[model samples]
Each structure stands twice: as C-alpha cells, then as structure tokens.
Target: METASAESVRKHVRVYVTVFVALMALTLITVTISTLHLQPAAAIIVALCIAALKASLVAAYFMHLISEKKLIYAALTLTVVLFLVLMVLPVSHFADRGL
Candidate 1:
C-alpha cells in the first residue's frame, strides 16, 4: 500500500516538473514575443494567449484541478467564461476608436 502511494506521489511530482518546464518555456516565448515590434493588437493577442496557456498549466498541475470533481471543473469553466467576457468587453471600447 505504501509503495502504491509512493508511486502516485512520484507521478504527481513528474507532472509538476513537466508543467514547470513548460511554464519556463512559455515565459521565454513570451519574452521573445514582447521584444518584437508587433502591431499592438497582435502583441496583445499573443501575450493573452500565452498567459492563458500558462494559467491552464498551473491550474491543471499545481492546483490539481485536472483530478478534481465535476463541480470544481464546472466552477473553473465558469470562471474562465467570466474572465473572457470581461476581457473581450474592452476590445469593443477599442473598436470604437477605429483601431
């Protein structure tokens, strides 16, 4: 029983390590993207996409959301939806400026 528990812990640790590496890679990519002189809209889109990916990874691995119950998943989904709605609303404000 102890060995099985240890194996499960090791699996979790491996997942954490993998996500950490991916987070690092995403950070590097974001940095590189920022150094480029992209159009403001494009840059914002890229940065937001990278941030979303990092958030997803952290939520899944570090927060153990992937293994959580359906109720938790539903809450997370609702949070993401709310966040998207809040973020996208600002784009309309920009659109009014003819950008």
Candidate 2:
C-alpha cells in the first residue's frame, strides 16, 4: 500500500475531529429536544433525523467511505434502500390492517 503523505494524514485527522465535534453537537441537541416537550411523533422524527445525520458522518469519516470506489457506493445504496423497504413493510402492514 502507498504511504500517505503527511499533509494527507493531517487532512484526514482534521476531518475526523470535525466529524467527532458534529456528532457531539448532535447528541446535545438530542438531549435538548427531549426536554423541550415536543409532541411524541415530532420528537421521534427529529431524533431519528439527527441519528441519521450522525450515522452518515460516522460512515463517511470514521469508516473511510468518503473516498471509496463506485462499487462500494452502489452496494451501500442498495443496502439503504433495502433497509428502508424492510422498515416500511411493517408499517404498511399495520396501515392495511387498520383499513
């Protein structure tokens, strides 16, 4: 494997630190929102959105996915799509049962 240049290493470190800080800020926001007495559905939605953002940052920076090949990206996209479909299936079933 090619050795990374010092500048490149420094850039990666900076990016990692920035992502860490953002994750931390999102965590604080999550806690803050909990105390704000938002409606149950709204709170769940906001928390899930923040969690998704944090997950994205973790995947991109910590997992080194930001620089991955196209094949990896395509696989990741497929995984996300399948995950969403799985998640929605149960909800769709409940909705159909209610009708």
Top lDDT prediction, candidate number: 2
TM-scores for every predicted model: 0.77, 0.88
Writing each residue's lDDT as its tens digit, candidate 2 over 11-78 gives 89998888989999999999998999899999999999999999999988888887888898999899
The TM-score measured for candidate 1 stands at: 0.77
Q: State the lDDT of candidate 1 residue by residue for 1-81, as single tens digits.
A: 124487798888988888999999999999998999799999999999999999989987788777788898898789989
Alpha carbon deviation, residue 3, candidate 1 (Å): 14
Name the weakest run of 10 consecutive residues (lDDT summed) in model 1.
1-10
Global Cα RMSD, each model: 3.6, 1.8
Distance from true location, Cα of 40 in model 1, Å: 0.8
Which one is best on TM-score?
A: 2
Give the total clashing residue pairs for model 1: 0
- Deviating ranges (above 4 Å) for candidate 1: 1-4, 88-99
